[model samples]
Target: MTEGSKLLSEMNERSREVFRRVVEGYLSSGEPVGSRTLTRSMSEKVSAATIRNVMQDLEYLGLLDSPHVSAGRVPTQLGLRMFVDGLMEVATVGPDDRAALDATLGSNERDVGTLLDRVGSALSGLTQGASLVLAPKREAPIRHIEFVSLAPDRALVVLVFADGHVENRVFRPPLGQTPSSMREAANFLNAVAEGKTLSDLRGHIAREIAAHRQELDGLAQDLVESGLALWQDAGESYERLIVRGRSNLIGAAEAAELARVRTLFDDLERKRDIVDFLELAEGGDGVRIFIGSENKLFSLSGSSLVVSPYMNADRKIIGAIGVIGPTRLNYGRIVPIVDYTAQLVGRLLSER
Candidate 1:
């Protein structure tokens, strides 16, 4: 055998059979796997002593984790990875599940961001697991944008996009403003800024207006600066956000351990960390399954994030879709579900 193939660790046929049953059981129950459980469940003939020895070998190889003497062994992260990569069969979604997923992909008349929020909410509700939706930062094309003043000290900005999307923002006025002044600002902005990004237009206009030593009154300058700040800040506000299933996590985890769970709840209150994870996946290629130690942000809270890229009509990865669940997730089921959801998100975007 070649060196590379030989280095690929695996068990014999009989041991493989036992390991499969053990892993599946552990995933289903979030519990350890005792030799008796394997021996009784599988038809493979093996002595308890032999199974014990094999478990020892697996532990040595970092595939099985032995928590304590009285407890049984469980699959470690590497073991789970290997099982997912090599042994996972593509489990089909059932009829109700298929209908549900199709329904989710169908009901939204919203833009990408709102659609993602709906998806996240659905996944969390369906699986009773934490769900996260990640939208593409650099790819939401501009259709149209406008600004209106709500008051002398308050201005309203409305953004419209080619994808039949709209967004709104309210902010402080530059210093002093009026309804007629707001009209001039909106007319001027809409005329020159119909097809540019909120940020790009804001920056370009700020530079041009500031450079002009020529004309307007102090009030017009104030209107310009306030509009610029509102544009910049509102652009940031539209960024991808994370929505977690606190209840789902609670259901999956030991809710009895309230202190630790509360801290976990508090950590996700910012939603920034999960957004960072989405940004990382958007910056890369396709599917990403971040194990426990791979990311410290997740490691601290014992969570795992699985993300997959979704494309637009131009075949650009305009966003990503995935689930956020506890570390002891059923990768066998959730992995395929996540992959399928990503495809659905892409298809929806393409239609738009």
Candidate 2:
């Protein structure tokens, strides 16, 4: 047997029962569990002294810890991990939740931002914790491009993608450019840049202008370069992580828990690190669990994440959906909820 399995197997029946009861109690109430409490709940007739001895043994095994000198003991991060991976019983998503998820996410909404917002809100309402959605990073190919003059020196660039998604960005036209010239530039791009990504179109337009500089007027050439440069620089704002229900973190009134929740808010503000952590789930097949300090990103907050990757029609991993809650959160209930939401997200993307 593996080392962890061997450790579990070596525990005697009474010790296992005592350890299970302690973890369960801690998870249910977020409080330290005492030996007397375990004695009362346990089916077998066990004395408080015997339970205390068992707890001491488990603590020595690095599975439990006493938060205070006199207070009852609580499960350590290791203990929680062991309980989740081996001892905990996971529950499936119920029919009502499934129907709610379907109703919320079943829309044919083509706007990616709107879809993700709805997803985050739905997950937050269901889980009663903060929800996160990592948007897809892949850019769709350009099917059409149009430029409309907004002012003497400003214009709106409308890009229509092959997937029927449209995006608009403001562009500053070069000096001495007219509306007719802007239209010409847009037409030229639409004719030649179709099916090419923004990056590819930038390079293609640069080379075309270099070779055929005399074919267009000076203002037209400058306008083309300006539009392409504007798009290339806009890449930073594209894919982003969406977060919702941060207030749920502050639901607990305990001073220590409130402090931890404040730290978690600070962690969420560091979007880049959270995105990198969520990206780890992209390589996995199904739900990925990061319990408490197991992930350095959330170690300070003492929070846990249950994330699952969603894919596109081509089965390419596109993004992730998950919930972030305290270590004492309901793991058994949330696991299947996350898993099912991920599958639903993938199916929705495929249909689109």
Best by lDDT: 2
Give a tens-digit lDDT track for model 2, residues 1-352: 5444666889999988988899999888988999988888998999999899999999999989999886488998888888888898999899987887888777777777788888888888888889888876546799999888888878888888887878888877887878778777887788778998775776788888888788777777788888776655363455467889898878843677788888888777767474566566865779888888776777778888888998889887778898999888788888899899888988887787
Residue lDDT tens for model 1, 9-120? 4467765665566678787888888887777776867777778887777777777888778548887777776666666565665566556777876874755676777777
Question: Best-fitting candidate, measured by TM-score?
Answer: 2
- Candidate 1 global CA lDDT score: 0.68
C-alpha root-mean-square deviation, each candidate:
5.4, 5.4
Candidate 2 weakest ten by summed lDDT: 230-239
Q: Candidate 2: where is the Cα deviation over 4 Å?
A: 1-3, 143-239
Model 1 segments more than 4 A misplaced = 1-11, 108-115, 135-194, 199-239, 242-244, 255-261, 283-285
For candidate 1, report its TM-score. Answer: 0.72
Q: Candidate 2 local accuracy as lDDT? A: 0.82
